[model samples]
Target: MRFIFKTDYDQDVRLAKHGGHVFWYGLLLLFLLASPWLLPEYWLAQLTFVLIYSVVGLGLMLLAGFTGLFSIGHAAFLGVGAYTQAVLSNMGWPFPLSLACAGLLSAAVGVVVGLPALRVKGIYLGIATLSFGFIVEEVLARWESVTGGNGGMHVKEPSIGAWKLDSGEEFYYLCLVVTVLSTLAIVNLLRSPTGRAFVAIRDSEISAQSMGIHLARYKTLSFALSAALAGLGGALYAHKIQFLSPDQFNIVQSIDLLLMVVIGGLGSVHGAFLGAIFLITMPQLIALGKDVLPPVIGQAPGLQAVVYGGVLIVFVLFEPMGLYGRWLKVRTFFSMFPFYRRGMFKRQKSFQKSDRLK
Candidate 1:
């Protein structure tokens, strides 16, 4: 009887795993690909923005979530990509070629920025990147020729042959496909041995070093990959808005990206999507809350900023793992149901101890 039950349980687990992989991915692919056809232009535009930042968020996740490198200045690379694409496209270059140039330019900047990582880690690395962001913002504001100075510039949409994608609805499909592909690419990369090495390095520099992983190489590789992805997203954003401005990609924007990564859940792949959505919609949501509430309870403008800051603080203070982590707990709890234990709220086990044990 015991042996029969064991066999049944193992078979059930295998079936569940198979179903999960195929069913979930199938749903995601269909939604991302078909969303433009299904939703109104408003929601489509919102989803496009979500996917755009999600590309950047995932890159940051790979760096901060997997490798323990918290980059607060990734906006600089984003600005580089946006400006490059804008300049190239304005100069009459083809869209695809210009987009490629944008990503490569950001990757070059990422490599240069990563050089300082050889001597710094943790908060110091974060400070270095933050300063880089400020410098980039200053350059963008000051460089009238390349960056268009404080006034900003326009960007042309991608076109090929007779079919011109001219509407938000049309751009929605392009953004969706690009986002889906980027997400899948990252997903595949993370499942490989290289991804595991990235996680191992995140767990412990000393331990990872002992295991023969070149810290400098993988670290720089993460930054380069992250910047490249951010650049791609920037180019997409440029097309989506059909405009470019230095103010759009500023230090505050970099901090907002970090907020998205944190609130969505650091390290979890799906959390990037969640983070982007929340970070984008939070102000709106909070405003709605004010309207929905009684007049006495209405949130003031200053309160919005306070609430935003509070959310970040609360997440970091109470649950450092972010929303996806909490979602996992909710899932595990319901999966077990009445048998759920109280300790479910403790914490998830990370890849390594001591490094980010707090």
Candidate 2:
């Protein structure tokens, strides 16, 4: 095991705490850079999607994981971003400008949603967001002039200057760059006072307020940031898919986004990436397994749904902290092998006396 000795506050808050972090992150970056050369065309497309989903996961993680504010209407923000990008690109806007506008529009909607949601918490907020999503869906369906209603709308390929990012490889690189930048931004945010305030609110909103943290401002900020990330992801997704549909951003998609962050590991940036990998790869793996299994098992209707739900249930029941959390436990266990305790990974069930009232 490696040890980190902090000599100063700067060293303590450094992005890479130890030499091992630098080495591993560098290696991961190198792998991502070379993935296009290593993987086939089909896998490359899947990887691009993984990167996009990771962006959405990061957004949800920021809001729910860090700020303790959950939303089930994130897909509505995604739809907003996708439509904004589509409309702007159709109007001949530059890719960068379109993307920025998409994010801003989505963030604006997020602030609107957060305003009333600030009065609620937990399940109530989730329900509020869920209703908001349905309302957005209806609006998209009726606004045929803009969203194209049930027929959907076509999206133009993103371009920079005279160069079009038309090919999968080009798009993969674009997504990679965005995903990397988003991840770095989140990591740095978590290391800042705002992120700490978010965590404080998560731990205890009352206590955070006692410490002079403005609950409404920070809560709204979290929603805006989360929605902006979703919008950015949606913009990329629209260009990648070359199509837009309100149905694509329905409650199911929102649930999938939720599952990604929850299964990846709440409150961990790496968990978002891990969750994205799982979300993209699991379906393909299931299909591959279907081909090998007996006809009855393989041909079962809704097998994908069953398997997906089962996996989520398993993760919730056995590994609530998700894949990253499990990995952390394994790493720690090995690092302190002989000293590891049996109850080390067990979940704590204790709560405050006030929480016992209801």
lDDT of 2 by residue, 1-358 (tens): 5576667988966788877889999999899999999999998999999999999899999998888899988899999999999999988898999999999999999999999667999999999999999999888888999889989999989988789888999999999999999999998898789998998898899999999999999999999999999999999999999998889999998888998888998878888989999999998999899999899999999898899899999999998878987887788789998898756655332443121111
Tens digits of per-residue lDDT, candidate 1, 1-358, equal 0022343556643422455667887887787778878888777778889888998888888888877888989888888988888888778777778888988888889989988887899899999999999999889989998878899888876765456678887777777777778877787787677787898888778998999999899889888988999998888888888887788888779889989889988888877988999977887788778878777668455767678799999999988778887876777787788887766455336433322221
Clashing pairs in 2: none
Clashing pairs in 1: none
* Candidate 1 wrongly placed segments (more than 4 Å): 1-17, 293-299, 344-358
Runs off by more than 4 Å, candidate 2: 347-358
Give candidate 1's whole-model lDDT. 0.81
Clashes of 1: 0
